[model samples]
Target chain A: MTEELNARDKEEVRQEESTHPGRSYRPDVDIFETAESLVLRADVPGVDESSVSVRLDDGVLSLEGRVSVQDYENLTPVATEYPIGNYLRRFQLSNDLDPEGIAARVTDGVLEVTFPKSAQAKPRQVQVTAG
Target chain B: MTRFRFASPFDSAGRLLTLQREVERASGNPFDAEQSPSGRGVFPSTNVFRDDDGLTLRMEVPGVSPADISVEARENTLTVSGERTIQIPEGTSYHRRERGAGRFARALQLPRDVDPTNVTATCKNGILTVRVAKSENAKPRQITVQAA
Candidate 1:
């Protein structure tokens, strides 16, 4: 009975490790800040444009997607280090972000998120009045 | 070796021998193909360019998000790694499958000496572009001559 319990515990641990490898679902991100907007780029291989979802709930930005590996049945896979699971990521947005105008798109496995800065956050030119 | 012979009509034991041979050759390794199973573990095709200002590296990685990629530079090498996942819908049968999954890693050696501290990466559309500024020693210098 003890041996069986130990075997089951090992299997559970393996399954947990495979599902959540403790790494970021999206491993790479590039952030670019410009005069008017901030652009974010992420690498999400094996996913399609349609499979990606981007949402802003409250002040948090979340990105989600899925990658399926149903193909290549004929060629046996000798080894794989990648864990398959639902990709998830979240970011806290600053007050300068214009959430209403934020835009996102995915192409060729890369996702780009553009956040336009609010008018109040942009630099303003102050005029001087001569006395 | 065992041999069999066919005899003439009048004399059944008279002989003409027959021989047979079989040849087998192993198939080519699948890794040579552009889209092999293992190939999915690395980033797709990429292009690198160098100019007076900096170096640019572009990789084709579709369907990924900005949060999914990671880039790190150590010594003279830059490493890019990421993961992509897909789920098959229930009741769907796949006729053909080509894309690969899991974690992928790609490392590149810069053509010119770069200031690792000033490296930047940008992704637009489906291309991941990494720009690294060249070190003073690696940048081109123009020399002027003064006539005496």
Candidate 2:
């Protein structure tokens, strides 16, 4: 059997202070590039569409998600392997992407963000003439 | 009297599978599981919670459809199995691929037998929760003292 992939616990974020009262984890993410845009997908279980936030400022993209702690309010843990927490992570975006054209959505607890490439960054076809 | 008997994250079968994977890695297998910076473990890591009524099992299965997952309870064992698929458009080039895909099944031994008919499951925002009610015969009972 192949080894299964496990979720990683993100260490404390020392750079910024969080307004939320719980731990902030770095959600697992996959990034890829298509012809028109750069796509990113992150696993943020427990977070719905309204609880997720995506912002780009000064070439840095930030992702944050808050999980509803109310779900486990009265339940006591019998055997625990993974902890519940909010999600936080950031990425540096190159100038080739157009910040205004970015689009994001959340489904099945996976957040997908598509950053469209700037007009100048797209490939241009040059006309070849007979010499 | 022991009130609870908790099962460790890795049961006998789980340990054996881990050992086999380790041996394969030592033998220079190319399809080696992607060694994440945080290392590897079972998929859809699970958490078990208990209350007066029953036990609840929660698993993280982002991007997985509810129809793809299955839960079964037999005797005192609870088994969760499912497949996760990630779709990528054609001609896409990956810069970072950390999410792993495929079929995963985990069997967990419960502290007591559960009523098969009383079990229920639900999925929301990629989290799957299975609630198994304790068997009628196993539930805790209170005995009242009669006036002497």
- Give the TM-score of chain A in candidate 2: 0.88
Cα lDDT, model 2, residue A85: 70
Model 2 pairs in collision: none
- Candidate 1: tens digits of C-alpha lDDT, residues A39-120: 7766565556776788899998888665432221122222222332335666788889999898988766666788898999
Per-model CA lDDT versus the true structure: 0.54, 0.75
- Each prediction's RMSD over C-alphas, in Å, is 25.3, 12.0
Query: Please, what are the lDDT tens digits per residue for candidate 2 over residues A62-130?
Result: 999887655775666655656667789899988999999999999999999999999899887989999
Global local distance difference test of model 1? 0.54
Tens digits of per-residue lDDT, candidate 2, B65-139, equal 899899887766667788888899999999998777788776666664567667899999999998988789887
Candidate 1 local lDDT, B18-110, one digit each (tens): 000000011122121234344432453444545566666655555545578888888677787776554443443333233334566666665
Q: What is the TM-score of chain A alone in each candidate?
A: 0.72, 0.88
TM-score result, candidate 2? 0.79
Give the DockQ of candidate 2.
0.28
Judge the docking of candidate 1 as incorrect, acceptable, medium or high. incorrect
